[model samples]
Target: MNARLRRIVTSAMALSLAVPLAACGEEQTDAGAGEKTIGLLLPENKAARYENFDYRIISRRIATLCLECELDYRNAKSAVDTQKMQFEGLVKKGVKVIILDPVDAQAAKSWVNSAAKKGVKVIAYDRLAEGDVAAYVSYDNESVGRLQGQGIATALGSQASTANVVMMNGSPTDPNAPSFKKGAHGVLDRKVQKIVSENDIPDWSPAEAKKKMTEVINALGPEGFDAVYSANDGMAGGIAEALKSAGIRNVPLGGQDAELPALQRIIRGTQSFTIYKEVRPEAETAAEIAFRLLEGKSIKSLTSTTADSASKSGIPAKLFSAEIVTRKNLKDTVVQDGVVRVDLLCTKDLATACKSLDLN
Candidate 1:
């Protein structure tokens, strides 16, 4: 393994030991007859990780931490008003600690402030919500964008310095979106020949990304841009379809969130790369932080860093590192870590590719 991959693996192992998901034979905290509750509010269901990994891992960890602590889970479905209602509902239920991934980070300021007034502590999960947040847990998002930019440059090979690129950014509502865009621009601005077209995709919609890509293709023609930088995997799927429709091939395309489809596309030689941020550590850490808050214990050991939101500064935070996943490291990273099962990734049509990669 390379130095970066080794560091990521080592850090993850250390975190897993610090806050184990399964504490076998360990003494558990009991709430007696009255059960305590922890509120979990996720931003959307569009991203596969929120439901499949974040919710499941966090819930399981919370259960292991305190058997009597019940989780009040709610998904906003990408609606700000809906999330506001959910936040209010959780606070009204007397839930003390709430884990929130805001649909609109800026709009969450008022909601979080209100929750604070009600003696409710909110832990900003994944996306940084603005307010008096008790704690924050997520990956180093700007580095994620830097990885994407580097992936595109690597895919472009000798033409990287003189390559024309199109940038497809994430939602305007998400605070992390600007960081990703800024980080990508930091590299692309100095590395690439020029950025021909750029757009901030609303809701990170795949269809809208497809429409934008089609327009860019029509405006600039097939050979105008040498590469495409998609902020996440879902939009990358649409951009890939647009490229296929335009009969344009061999253009380097990059994305984040190592989704199943993006991995398959990488194997099929369509999408070039995807950033894999291990959500297990992120979610489990958040759960541990929540439990600590409930117990009135200090989270100093867990959160070694601080972050700033619009309304709050010096908020305790724990940010994990991410890795760049390509066809080459597919087996070593996601498959080895059990993030994606071989059976789920290797379909009948992809059997040959899977076998070649020794994925099965």
Candidate 2:
């Protein structure tokens, strides 16, 4: 790891030591009379990481940062209306500091403005929700797309210059989607023969991606596209299934989010690569920023840079780096970082593959 990444990992480790093991499951609302509340609103649960990793990590980090602060957590399940209602509810409950991952970035402008009117500080988490955001925490999303593009080019090898690529992008409502698309296009347009087909999926739905891939296959035949670029692992899973159903094999496929199943597919030689953005530091950083904001403390030390949204400029932001995970460095990247355990990743069925990679 580089110096900055090492510093982030070190900070996360130190914060993790603050909360005891026994306090992990304690009710967050069981605070004293004068205790404050921090609201956490996530965009969706369809992607397992939001509920499985992000929520748990942020909640735990908050507990570690402020034992007296209560967390009001809610998931929008990918519904804009639901998220709006949830945001309104949080404001009504007088939550002064809210960490919001909006379902629709554009729609969040009014919500953020409303919050600001009530003297509530809103921290944009993961997705850059437009408005008067106090602080934004996420990976360099355009860099993520560039990494995916580079992975595809590398996987294509000698055929990269002549390869036809199909692109399956994420939800349009997500503010980050356009940047990912732009970054990927920046590389792929110059590297590949041509982009044969492209589609922006709704809700980042895997089923929709599969259906679109199937349509592309029907229109262009098996040899039409040499490789596929998916914006995320969830949709990539759908694309993988679509390829399988069509009996298409050995096509270079790439995705982000380093999801477990995607990593397994990489081991099995189905998927080419995944971009692993360490969620721990991102979540922990958000928690720390939110806590500091709640306490009216300066967060100049926490944020590394500034980010501009559609409705806001020079917003305090901490953007982290990501790594592209391929079969060659599986052990070095995710394994060494303890993102996934060898025992769990190397299942009974994958014993030979595990042995071949010396993952055991």
- The Cα local distance difference test for each model comes to 0.87, 0.88
lDDT by residue for model 2 over 265-302, one digit each (tens)? 99999999999998888998999999999999999999
Across 209-278, the per-residue lDDT of candidate 1 in tens digits comes to 9999999999999989999999999999999999999999989999999899999998888999999998
Where in model 2 is the C-alpha error above 4 Å? 1-35
In model 1, which regions exceed 4 Å deviation? 1-35
The clash count for each model shown is 0, 0
Q: In candidate 2, where is summed lDDT lowest over 10 consecutive residues?
A: 21-30
Models 1 onward score TM values of 0.91, 0.92
Candidate 2 total steric clashes: 0
Best by lDDT: 2
The local distance difference test score of model 2 is 0.88
Query: Lowest-lDDT window of 10 residues in candidate 1?
Result: 20-29
| Alpha-carbon RMSD to native, per candidate | 5.5, 3.7
User: Residue 145 of candidate 2: its Cα lDDT?
Assistant: 87
